[model samples]
Target: MTTTTTWALARVLRDRDASLYLAGVVVSGFGTSALWLASGVWVKDLTGSDGLAALCMLAMWAPTLAGPFLGTLTDRTRRKPLLIGTNLLLAALLLTLFTVDSPDRLWLLFAVLFVYGAAGVVHDAAESALVAGAVPAPLLGDFNGLRMTATEGMKLLAPLAGAGLYAAYGGASVALLDAVTFVVATGLYACLRVRESRPEPRAGGRRKQTAEGARFLWAHPGLRPLVLAGGTTMLFAGLSGAMVYAVIDGLGRAPAYAGVLYAVQGAGSVVIGLASGPALRRLGERRFAAYGIALTAAAAGLRAIPSDPVALVCSAAIGAGLPCVLIAALTAVQRETPDALLGRTAATANSLVFTPNVVGLAAGAALVELLDVRLVSAVIGLAWLVTAVPLFQNPASASRTATRSPSDANPA
Candidate 1:
């Protein structure tokens, strides 16, 4: 079945060289997960204060503040060098993780995390841009589905391997592995050959690329609402991560239980990510996203129901539904926007959504420290539920057919 899916996905890519890009992403994922797993452990080991450990968690979304500018850059530049360059930088940072011994240097970790997060924004923007360039827009839903499945598969496996390496070898060894993966990913990207050409102008031809990209996004009625929905959800989801340790502590579960829950969540994501193409085809992107948002709302409500086996199941459900929301939002952006603006669109979308994520993390951390874990989780969950209301009221459903060339409009 995996083989069949790979072949089908290859056909959609339409270029044999595209496989190298996917392989690069997979290798990058392994490194990313390993670094993440090792970093928190390394920090806590250095500082006995739980508060310090919590601050390190904020690194995930801090760079999101610069997303708009990053998006502008991505739109203006060719993607390949950016992809290769960022991975190289990440490899250097991972190696640096081995040298930090004092808690005071912890601020450096946040700096690294922030930079990494910023680079990640670029990666996502570039990947979307590349994919849009590589395949017809109409087939984006399916291609993205396959990509999501591969990504979730990596998410499921990387942590286990990372955790094991950390236990047996140490943070330095794990860092070494992460560095190696980045190097490998860079090599793979170098091999993939994508045609780089000037992107065509949109309806208004006079504007600069970045300005035009921004103008195009603002002009689209459907896109505005979709961004609102996606951004709001990401903010709350970022908040939820902050509450994980608190939730586990409140439930009297071991720290490892958080891992177990995440594993379950990843399992659910893999199942759905693999089917995202079919789901989009069956329901269309708007409807699929609407249902997904509703599911997320339901899941959020479930988190507030009380901590129990049922609640845990519901928590897992929240993870399961997240990928659907992601797939839908990206599909909408990919379908509605032109190739010239693909990177910027993705970056702007991320910027709009992730800014809240930074706020959400701070809010969640404050709530967990002052209120209690369960309450923080509940409040955030309810807030996420609110984001879904727009989905039900204004379903932005539009099917973008693929264009024959980059010059074509409404390319699927």
Candidate 2:
């Protein structure tokens, strides 16, 4: 690392509250990552039904569709207390899974997963709002980058631990492990010391407050393009993900090859997490996002080829490029939004950005059966390239001064 990059990372780490917040994320994230993969496997083992196992994944994701509505609770409550309570509640809920000893109890598993997902939505919204208040503005990018690194690192490591525990001691043991982490995270949240200003009083009913976030996101010139770019990238990523099986089949490789590609991709994401802060400081969010999209476009186009080495490289490139857009969009939201609306706005943005991937996943699954894999890859690639045109021409990119919001200029 360069001297400057090393110094920037150290600066973020040195902040007491930022360090505690990141620690909470790391502990909680490890368990969540493990449970995410293990839930499907546990269901499959008990029921021997692929459809039921898939439903476990769906149950967890279904709550994201209601993120905007659930996020309003964060705006109404004190954020730190909400975060602490949410984690404790999730830990208690996971304990209920200890009763699932047979296929007849699978309904309980599904119900618990659904509630887990819902709590996650609220917890994330509150955390985003809290971070904007807790961390210094100059270090927000670095904090976000380190946060990504911690989560993605868990993605690489935690599943293995969860699976090993499950295999040796069964699903109940895995739930206990996850529950323990949540308790740890709750402690970390309790340790955080920061002043959280009370949110402004709502002028209207719940219905009106819910829509306020979406409206603000659309109205902000600097945020609008970055968010759009994130959604577009996820759409193509879903389409490309559907083509993975076909690519392996064409290469005359086994299903396990997909795991190799995933590991390579994770490695690339870790590197990007370490470097994104420096890149954001130099290029600004708009240009940083556009360049990342362009790289993803190029990588997606390369997936049309059948070479294994080329495919691995393209997977790494896709991983590196995608997170750049996500971090840029998140940093923009944090910098631009007022404290009063931060919780709702961040939640709404999460819903808008991720909902399209669910759509593309379904669409791509259907289309892949009817279309050629290479042709689908090419089309997704071209679509990403087209999406970048607006970013290149965005009026905010004309001058660095234009990208700073009034809140950023005079932070309270």
Candidate 3:
């Protein structure tokens, strides 16, 4: 809001370690988003079925349903090594696209997409866990804001970029650009100088680490509702996202228009991500979390109304609400959970939260064949809205403290 606040936010990005990681995230994000857009368009062009086009959406995200396993593994390994190795693997996979036609070997596309999703899970979990080690806990909100902004900004641009590249140079050329971006990101991760001060495992921690993380989430009187609401938001968001290609394809619009829509969605995310910190500071995490769910439901409801212009408006609103909910929930975890358990706790929550997305994407695609896409959107929208009612009903929403850092919440 104030110049001082803006200056403070800028300083979070200026930090040497944070800056390098942010740059890598931005480039890698560009690559990921480009691939998603290109692959979705490619699948539709080749298959000539809206259902199949929507299946491509499932291919891109369903593997992430196994995210908890990957998240736990990420916590066990060194961060830089994982990032570098996965980046290289993803790069190679992108390169392989030139040699094989995905249309003929649809299963191959699934395999590649699954690997990409799995790798993405590990990458995100490690990268986020590593941040607490780089920046002070007090500034976690600002740091999270910067990461969200970079990610969403990439989502906004990559679609347009990928579409143009596909039209002129083709999918192979786009894949080549993605491979180069990964290579650069890998190099940047290697060059980041700050060594992670890994948290000491708790006594008998090895056996109980995963269990404790699960128990922590289950026992948290406050977090259960937030997780449920997050899961609901993910479902609707995934459902709505799957329908984007169908909407455009049905109109006989170029895939580039899908990119434009994504860009607009990204613009909305950027605005919300930047403001998330200030909102958390003012609203406290709990009520803000409730508000995020409410906003998401409202956005999804708007989505069911069925007009191109209205769809864009709804998409942007939901896109904006997602970052707010994510930041609130993640910041709450960071504020309430212990340092020793941060990685596992994060893994557990992220996996559960994303599970509905897997279900939602598949269901969204399948539902469209049986019913009107707009009606399906309405059903999913109403479902998300009903699911979030707990956020408002829970008395804890009013009394929860938001400013306490993870260390403050857990003294050891």
Reference-based TM-score of each model: 0.82, 0.95, 0.81
Report the poorest 10 consecutive residues by lDDT, candidate 2: 403-412
For model 1, residues 1-412, the per-residue Cα lDDT tens digits are 3654555565766655556666777888887877787778877888876666666556866666666567766666678887888889988987776666687777777788778888888888988887777666656776777667678778888877888998898778887898898899989877767878654434533334445445555556567677777777777777776777776776677887877777777777777766677677777766677677767667765665446685578666876677776788788888878766678778877777667767777777777788856566666667777776666665334333232332332312
RMSD of each: 5.1, 3.7, 4.9
lDDT (tens digit, per residue) of candidate 2 on 315-339 = 8998888888899989989998878
Write down the worst ten-residue block by lDDT for model 1. 403-412
In model 2, which runs have C-alpha deviations exceeding 4 angstroms? Answer: 396-412
Task: Report the candidate with higher TM-score, 2 versus 3.
Answer: 2
Ranking by TM-score: 2, 1, 3
**Which candidate achieves the best TM-score against the true structure?**
2
After the best TM-score superposition of candidate 3, give how far the Cα of residue 350 lies from its true spot, in angstroms: 1.9
Best candidate (score: lDDT): 2
Selected candidate, larger TM-score, 1 vs 2? 2
Question: Which sequence of candidate numbers ranks them by lDDT, best first?
Answer: 2, 3, 1
The regions of model 1 sitting more than 4 angstroms off are: 1-18, 103-108, 198-212, 239-252, 368-386, 393-412
